[model samples]
Target: MTTTVVGVDGSPDSDLAVEWAAADAARRHRPLHIVHAYLSPFVAAQVAVPTSGGFEPVLRAAAEGTLGAAVARASSVAAGLDITTDMPAGEAPAALLDAARRAALLVVGCGHAAMAGLLPGSVSRAAVHHAACSVAVVK
Candidate 1:
């Protein structure tokens, strides 16, 4: 089935985007896919450690929590909606674009004055330009 894909980063703006995407998906009878991209600090660490110990787990847990919260919020707003969540290990924009490839629509959150200045947030701007499907940026 066609899906409405939303990128969430545990921000209030992303929460708004989730709400908007959920409603649109419910109305259109499409599945709602909530995606969160997590880039572990280890990936950026210049020196490799024998083990990350608790650090990697903590980051993964937080990412899962963010996805869970978004799922809960979406479920509350649109009961009986087909909702799914993803945590891709990469940059937000690349993950969102990958999800968008098979989606009917891609929704992302933007901050106030996102477009008034020189650039919108990098992820939202990149998704707007590179997503395979139509993109909606909720502010």
Candidate 2:
């Protein structure tokens, strides 16, 4: 079955989006897929560091923690809900879009437009404009 996919970034807005996506998945009888993409400065700079140490470990740990928190939040919203998670290492918007390739809905969090600006964050804006399925921008 097509899933309901949500992108998380360890922000309160993302937590809210996780909750919303979980509930929506339950209501629609679809699995919930959570994505947390880690953009590494090392990769962007084309600097290869040993996997044993440096930014790689730190970023992976942080990404795992974020995904774990999101899973707990989602479970709290919908007990026994079928859920899966992906921690893709790349740009947030691209990772989220790829993860939602077969999704029925793509959910993302955005800061308050008034506070951040008149426009939603780049990731959310990209998802809304480019996602193949319906997009939900939860503030």
Predicted model with the maximum TM-score: 2
- Model 1 CA lDDT for position 37: 76
- Give the lowest summed-lDDT range of ten residues in model 1: 111-120
Error of 2 at 6 (Å): 0.4
Candidate 1 lDDT tens digits, 3-80: 999998888898999999999999999999999876533353533322466445666788899899999999999999
Considering every candidate listed, which one attains the maximal lDDT? 2
Judged by whole-model lDDT over C-alpha atoms, candidate 2 comes out at 0.84
Model 1 C-alpha RMSD vs. true structure (Å) is: 4.3
How good is model 2 by TM-score? 0.87
TM-score of each: 0.86, 0.87
Q: Residues 1-139, candidate 2, lDDT per residue (tens digit)?
A: 8999999988889889999999999999999999988654336456564566777788788889989999999999999999999988777778888987889999999853222222448779889889999999998
* Candidate 2 residue spans exceeding 4 A from truth: 41-43, 46-52, 112-120
Task: Quantify all predictions' global Cα lDDT against the true fold.
Answer: 0.82, 0.84
lDDT of 1: 0.82
